[model samples]
Target: MPVTQSDIALAHHLADAAGAVIRGYFRQPAGLEIKEDRSPVTLADREAEAAMRRLIEAERSGDGIVGEEYGTKDGVTNRRWVLDPIDGTHSFTAGRAIFGTLIALVEDGWPVLGVIDQPVQRERWIGVAGRPTTFNGTPVRTRACPQLEGAVMATTSPHYFGEDAALRYLALTAATSGGHNRMTPIYGGDCYNYGLLASGQIDLVCESGLKLHDFAALVPVAEGAGGRMCDWNGDPLTTDSDGHVLAIGDPARVDDVLEALHRVHD
Candidate 1:
């Protein structure tokens, strides 16, 4: 079903509520703890998610919820809200403004709307399937990169790619590099990178080990901006996809980049 105006309004409300809760705890040393996975969690992450959940339960009681800090709350309706209260928690704790709240609506196992809200920067990106992406209320579109050689790219970090996967990324990077049109990959900025890509500030973003909440919000943002997002195997991303993901602002270069990455995996 097409996302309605009511759905879009609800998405903005959720982001506003989450942003309110997050701004209260941002960079204030509000009792940080390391999760079992070795990633840091803070009061901001928990409280922001709780605030959003409260709004969701109150406004759309029938919709399910999946979140990072908190567990899932299943509802009878096939529609679900996926939340990453603070996507770049590490950056958030380190006093950086790159962290943002990610929200996605997955209906019948497919994402239909997404929002990337950076409370600190007061910038937000809203994406709805089949609609033009908006950044701070202005329509935005992605820039074209005809080839890999001159394309500008970004990732959170190479370390997150892991040892074995790092080699695969390195090979892909080498393929984009040449004497004059060398591709210098920018590091860091998590969810913000996808928002920038949608705004045409970036061309490619490749990352691995992402979860449903991690990359689900990204799909709509990229696709709405006239780009494409898929798993490294060139499959459409869904709740069932493997963690490997790729985002290219230019559709023409997707096959070439995907084939290059596939070579490393093969």
Candidate 2:
């Protein structure tokens, strides 16, 4: 089924609710704790996710929900909203404004709509399948970089990658750099990197170990902004993806990026 304008409006509402809760905890995350996986969680993460869930339950009853802090709530319909209240807790708790609230509406295993909202910066990017992405009410487009040669790349952190994957990433950067390109590499941004790519500030992003909420909202945003998003295998993103992701500003460059990931390392 196609994503309705009403659904888009509700997505904004969800982001609004989540952002409201997160903004209150800026610079003062309460009840911070390390999860069993060793990732940090905070009161802002929990409360913001809760707030978004409440709205989904109210406005879009019967829609499923998957959240980072609270886990899953099954629904009768195929559509589910994947929510990550604050994507970068380290940045959030440390008083950085790069953290964001991610909301994705996945219908029949495909993301039909996505929103990345940075409450502190008051920047919101909305992407609906088959529609252009928007940032702060203005349409955004990715910069054209057809090959890895001159592309600017980012990942939240290379530390998030496993040893083998880390080696592959390093090889990819090496391929993009040390040539006439002088390709720039960025270290930290979390979900914000996708937003920046949508707005033409970034060229490519590679990440691993992400869950549904982390990358679901990013797919539509990147694609809607005239880019391509896929797993490292050059396949489209799905609800069950293994979490290895690449977002390239230009569709023509995907093969180059994938080639570097494979050929340079293997």
Candidate 3:
């Protein structure tokens, strides 16, 4: 189904609501705690998602919602919203400005629109299905990286990769670097890297253990900007993905990265 202009406007409105809550706690000391998964969660994340939820419930009462801080809210319609109020919570809690609010709309279980809003940086990227991606209302495109040797790669962190996956990721980056010694992949950008890739700043992003909310907003943004984002096996990302994700500015380079990732033992 096609996304209506009203839907796009509501997506931005959701981002604005999330951003307002996030910006209030941007640099101030936040009340933080560790979830059972050992990941950090702060008041900013909780309040921001709540803010978006309030607006969503008020405006689109029939739409479902899935958020990082709060659990699922079943809806009466097929349209659903995925929210990650603070994608880079570690950075956010550390007083870094790399964190952003992620908003994505899934229609019939498929993402049709996405927004990445960096409140501190005042940068926003909006992508809708069958439409050109926009950065602050201006159309944006990805830079070309016909090959891997010169491509800039980014990942949130290797710590999330576990031992076996980390080795494979290193091998893949080695291939991109032309050898094991030539490349140093950038680290710690979180969802910001995907927004950058959509805007053509980064070339490739490979990460493991992403949830629906983690990479959901990135799909439309990447594809809308002339890039491809998929699983490690080149499968389209969805709610059922295995959490291993690959986003490349150049579609031609995917096979090479996948091959390198498989060269190592699992």
List, residue by residue over 207-247, the lDDT tens digit for candidate 3.
Answer: 99999999889999999999998898889888888999999
Candidate 2 has its poorest 10 consecutive residues by lDDT at: 175-184
- 69-123, model 2: which lDDT tens digit per residue? 9999999999999999999998898888998899999999999899999998999
- TM-scores, all candidates, are 0.96, 0.97, 0.97
Q: In model 2, which residue pairs have backbone atoms overlapping below 3 Å?
A: none
lDDT of 1 by residue, 16-58 (tens): 9988888888778778999999989998899999999999999
CA RMSD of all predictions: 1.6, 1.5, 1.2
- Give the poorly placed runs of model 2, Cα more than 4 Å off: 179-184
Candidate number that wins on TM-score, 1 or 2: 2
The lDDT per prediction is 0.89, 0.91, 0.89
Best of the candidates, lDDT: 2
Clashing pairs in 1: none
